[model samples]
Target: MDVSGAGGLTDDRVLLGRTSTAERVADILRTRIAEGYFPPGARLSEESIGGALGVSRNTLREAFRLLTHERLLVHELNRGVFVRVLAVGDVDDIYRTRRLVECAVVRGLGQPPFAVDGLAAAVAEGEAAARADDWTGVSTANIHFHRELVALAGSARTDELMRGVLAELRLAFHVVDDPHALHEPYLRRNREILDALRAGERASAERLLARYLDDSRTRVAAAYAQAVDDPAGSAG
Candidate 1:
């Protein structure tokens, strides 16, 4: 696939900086993975990607190795590299982590010294996407919403962790039968949570977020189960 237009890393200028060129390439690929440009199980064509990104074969290999270590990509002996497909357990684990972290963020939101600007902005973006009938855009904006939710904690470590969690969530989202069905209902819920947070209704917001995640977890897990059972019948 042509990733030159996606992944926020389209610049082809020679990579030269403190970090190795391979690491820079890996970052680009990671962004692509998170953005859903390269869906789960999509094969990475070294020649196409390397040439498109203006990188050498050696650098691409190194970048692939990095993503493999991050569990975003896998390498088979003769099959080359493909995006890692999450198992049902992986889906459950991701939600479990989110419940612990995100709910806590909402619980703490009403406390003094917090920022809801990011969260509000994410909601606006999602609403705009929904208005435009862009399911993918809604999905992207939803991911940003949760990422910003975690940022309310003002912890660098937590923000970094959510980045990985959100990326893995994208992998599972690719299997859902109806992106609109799965996401449209939740847009209103997101707005409700934001409103509660703004009103200092911490308890209400936390409850809303818990229910929201539980429903989403069930939906995505069920869809992933169906996809794993019959890949040919799965949705994209």
Candidate 2:
């Protein structure tokens, strides 16, 4: 019996091989952390997680280090790894930077001289994810859309900073109770923002994007406050 056709092997092992143990462990840990399977400040034990992922402690440690550098995990001397929680000031600074970066992207928008098909595709994906009630997918697509939006600024540094901001925002999303409520209404708003850009109304798009950012900040802060007040109620 050929194990190859049974999803066991392939002609190109390089292409069909399973992900590296470290990469797989990192991905699992990242997804769980993002999905709130492990709440902020939850300590992670290498031995237990290695057992769960069928990986060595070394591999799991590598994964932990990766996430720690990404700001998703925190490692302290004499203390093990724990999920990083965003402070109120961190959230405030995140939105302030987002407003500056994203508004600039919108302000630079104009008709068809640049290809925005990628942005359009990301918006479509986000809308579909929202409809499917896949909050994680919705959040991922939302980040992609805005990242592409900021990419229009033609600055690699801006793009890198935006990526970090988006990851921190994902942490905020996990902390909030009603994730859908925070993202659902923005589907139309994103479309409208794109429409304004396509119509060459750069100023209008900038205004709309600024307003959207403000509203999102308000919602996130309210949710964070509620989460703080009632810990058990806000399980992402």
Candidate 3:
């Protein structure tokens, strides 16, 4: 409850409508988790959120169950649901998945003149966020960049899978003590990857993405472990 808890509910209301269903509620909550509106360990108050979204308690509960299954939320007996704080191993697994999916997406490009406009746009988004000193926005932009990168595969199934995986990754990001350290270093690298894709250098783009995922996995996993192990830290 020390985190935003239910206090962000008023602002969150506009995200949903009176016609909201469980999946829609789940999607909104997932986006909030990724955006850090509900940071790691923040207790979710059912009354607040349900009232804000104009959804029934059952629908809200269903959405909570969905995110719980995704490893993005947890329900404790006698205590309300809370945003999940990922373990260090979870961090490693996330990056490993990213490397596998994202790199493969790039490697599968059979020839040149790939449609990389989305990637370029995402890169520009990150650059603009960086210029505005919006670190969280940079992180969001990075998410967009990766989403665009994976979109090149033209697989709806892969897109949904990566969306869940990336949302889980953002849970780990919330546990990180320094957002800038977690995201700033990746902006130029995103542009580099975009450039490679633009030039039709599939292999080059794949390698760059692989290395980027490796470095990020190392940094985030270590920081996350430290945050979890240190009693004074707010890992969850």
Candidate 4:
């Protein structure tokens, strides 16, 4: 769904009187990237996108700058902008952060002081997506589950950071050969972690989450390695 329109710029005045059009455009483009509509290494056609979205070139460039700062887009001297493809080191760092933050949150919830509703909800979402064979949905719910787990800490700052981390993580997932095979095994693991949290088994939950992050990092790193070793045969 190309969400650009000739009238969207003018309509923005009525929809959000004081909001910056460039910011709105950035949000739209960011969502598109996150949804994998623009795969890793795919060139972003500024002229075409600007025309489609009915925005000036300047506005589109601002949007590109914003995403670039978020590490979602990268610019090369002659190649314009493309969605970032995560390297093995990037994968390692992301998982390291996840383990440090998420495991700490789980460890603190020793007696279930916080509500498990968010965690439970994410688990249910993953389960439903799995039943429907929606691998993308499953992957989304999986990230949501981790996000919700971070929310247990009640820190807005951590939540914001995890959102960016998960978005980058999704880029890695977008390159995997089989979404179903990649994500199917984790649906049950999410449930197990949720159950541990619900049971107030803090140690058990932390252990499970640590293992999950470790496994995911290893799998994604291998996928990236394969892509680099054999670009022609790579899924991305």
Per-candidate clash tally: 0, 0, 0, 0
- What's the ranking of the predictions by TM-score, best on top? 3, 1, 4, 2
RMSD of 1: 3.1
lDDT of model 4 at position 69: 90
**TM of each candidate vs. truth:** 0.85, 0.72, 0.90, 0.80
**Full candidate order by lDDT, most accurate first:** 3, 1, 4, 2
Q: lDDT per residue, candidate 4, 11-73, as tens digits?
A: 333432355488778766765666566778878887667766667798889989988898988
Where model 1 places Cα greater than 4 Å from the true spot, the runs are: 1-24, 52-59, 232-236
- The local distance difference test score of model 2 is 0.72
How does candidate 4 score on lDDT? 0.78
Encode model 2's per-residue lDDT on 71-170: one tens digit a residue: 8788878878877888766777789989988997766655555557777998999989987889767877787788789988888888767766676677
Candidate 1 C-alpha lDDT tens digits along 1-236:
22324333445334534444897788678767877888888888887787667778999999999888878888989878888888889999999999999998777664743567888999999999999999888999999999888998879888877887888889888876678877898899999988988877788888999999999888878877887888788543
Instruction: List lDDT for all candidates, in order.
Output: 0.82, 0.72, 0.85, 0.78
Q: Give the range of the ten consecutive residues with the poorest summed lDDT in model 2.
A: 1-10
Backbone clash tally for model 4? 0
**TM-score, predicted candidate 4 vs. hidden true structure:** 0.80
Preferred candidate (TM-score higher): 3 or 4 = 3
Model 3 scores worst on lDDT over the 10 consecutive residues at 1-10
lDDT of 2 at 182: 76
